[model samples]
Target: MLDEGFTYGGLLMGLAALVLWIRLALRAFPSVETMIARYQDEFVVPEARSHGELGRIAACATAMALTFSAIGYAIPD
Candidate 1:
């Protein structure tokens, strides 16, 4: 169980990093709006005005990172 938790924590860390990287990349490329709109045709948007999806993804990633950190702290040596 401990090993599995550790593995999941690492995966979450990687995902968090990827999300942060994408956020930075989007910031660098202001043209992301066009790409996002292009991809929008693939699905329905529930909250079109709520900071978009990327913002929510980043927020979720940040929350996962914090949860992992807390789990790590609770793990035994």
Candidate 2:
């Protein structure tokens, strides 16, 4: 009962996180290209390279969501 609810909740949370991170990564893609072109000759700081970080986060979120959903479904009702 309570455990089932928690399992579903975690699954849903993971899915939501995956969606948000993917959205952010997509939005940042264009800007990332532009930033690279604009700063081709300059030394861009690590803090400014957020698009790469967002991509990594999105990938992790996707993996997390997949694992969470798998575990949730594998749990016996």
Candidate 3:
């Protein structure tokens, strides 16, 4: 039971953190394109890539996190 609790707590914390991060990001960047344009050279990593590697990384992280959370929830304790 303690293990289950820990897993659930971790999942909750991760989800909460993700939500807070996304909220902060939204607040900081009301317009993604405008923000990108403002700090294109400085902020954009993996230089010269139009699609933007950072964006791809975020997408991959989101997918992996969701998949792990689902597995955590589905696995028997």
Residue pairs with clashing backbones, model 2: none
RMSD per candidate (Å) reads 8.5, 5.4, 7.8
Using lDDT as the measure, name the better of candidate 1 and candidate 3. 1
User: Which portions of model 2 show Cα errors greater than 4 Å?
Assistant: 2-7, 25-49
**TM-score, predicted candidate 3 vs. hidden true structure:** 0.41
Write candidate 1's Cα lDDT for 16-67 as tens digits: 7686767656565435555687688744344323345666676677677767
Q: After superposition, how far is residue 5 of candidate 3 from its true place, in Å?
A: 11
TM-score of 2: 0.49
What is the Å distance of residue 47 in model 2 from its true position? Answer: 14
What TM-score fits each model?
A: 0.45, 0.49, 0.41
Q: Write the per-residue lDDT of candidate 2 for residues 1-77, one digit (tens) a residue.
A: 65466567668768777787768856755557568856687755544545667677767766776776676667787
Clash number for candidate 3: 0
**C-alpha RMSD in Å of predicted model 3 compared with the true structure:** 7.8
- TM-score winner between 2 and 3, please give it: 2
* Stretches of candidate 3 exceeding 4 Å from the true structure: 1-51
Clashes of each: 0, 0, 0
